[model samples]
Target: MLTAKEIDEQLSILQETGRKISECFSSFGSRMDFKPSPEKWSARQVLHHLTDSEIVLAYRLRTLLSENQPKLKAFNQNNWSATLAPEQEELPLMKSCFEANRNLTIRLLKKIPASLWEKKGVHEEAGEMRTYDLVVRNTSHCLRHLEQLQKLTEASQAVKL
Candidate 1:
């Protein structure tokens, strides 16, 4: 169980995610498609993953709040990236989708009662988790990929092409 203060901090981080992503990608300029290697994802692909993750996490959060110990499904992100062809996705549209969904989720989080944050759910792979756990996990996931995007931008700059 997280303290109220801790939960507030986590929510703040979640709210800033889309803005931070835009800031990080601003440095990438024309290198959104630049991958470190053929096997790895590009900045664009990471954006797609983050957007997709926000949508999935929102659904999980809603389920946890509305149901009693609902079983949450796990998604294969790598497979989504490969099959979705994020490299071919339009940057503006992807960003809009991410920001819009994130905004709606934030609004929902803010309006929910504090006790609802403790609502529990069972994830297929992660086992039992509280709604607050999803909040923390999702925020950390966003920050990790934000750092990845920053590193990708640096690597892209280093490459002549």
Candidate 2:
């Protein structure tokens, strides 16, 4: 069982992720579409991936909250990036979706009783996961991508300078 302080800290990081992503996007300027190589994902793709991931997270949480031992689905993000995320590059809209969904998820999480935090879901690929596990997993996932965006931003900036 995670301590309340630990849970709060994770939530705080998750909340900050959207703001950090927005800042990174703002800083990207001309580098918004940059990719380090042919195989690498550009910032726009990452943005879309994050947005899609958040949408999935919301659904997963709802399933966990309402169902007993729900079977969770896993997606191949690389495939989604190639097929779905590239259709549009509307940064503002994507940003809004990401932030709004994240906020909604956070609000929903706050209302969940501590007893329910351990609600279990069996992911197709990841096996068993608790509601709290999703929270921690997503916090780390977002932070990793935020760092990736920052580095991509710097790389893109350097090339243009």
Best by TM-score: 1
34-140 per-residue lDDT for model 1 (tens digits): 98999878888888899899889879988889999899999999999889888778788877888888888888988988888888999998889988888888888
Pairs of residues clashing in candidate 2 = none
Q: Supply the global lDDT for candidate 1.
A: 0.85
C-alpha lDDT (0 to 100) for residue 25 of candidate 1:
48
In model 2, what lDDT does residue 63 have?
96
Give the residue spans of candidate 2 off by over 4 A.
85-87
Task: State each model's CA lDDT, in order.
Answer: 0.85, 0.84
The lowest-lDDT stretch of 10 consecutive residues in candidate 1 is 21-30
The window of 10 residues in a row where model 2 has the poorest summed lDDT is: 21-30
TM-score of each: 0.94, 0.94
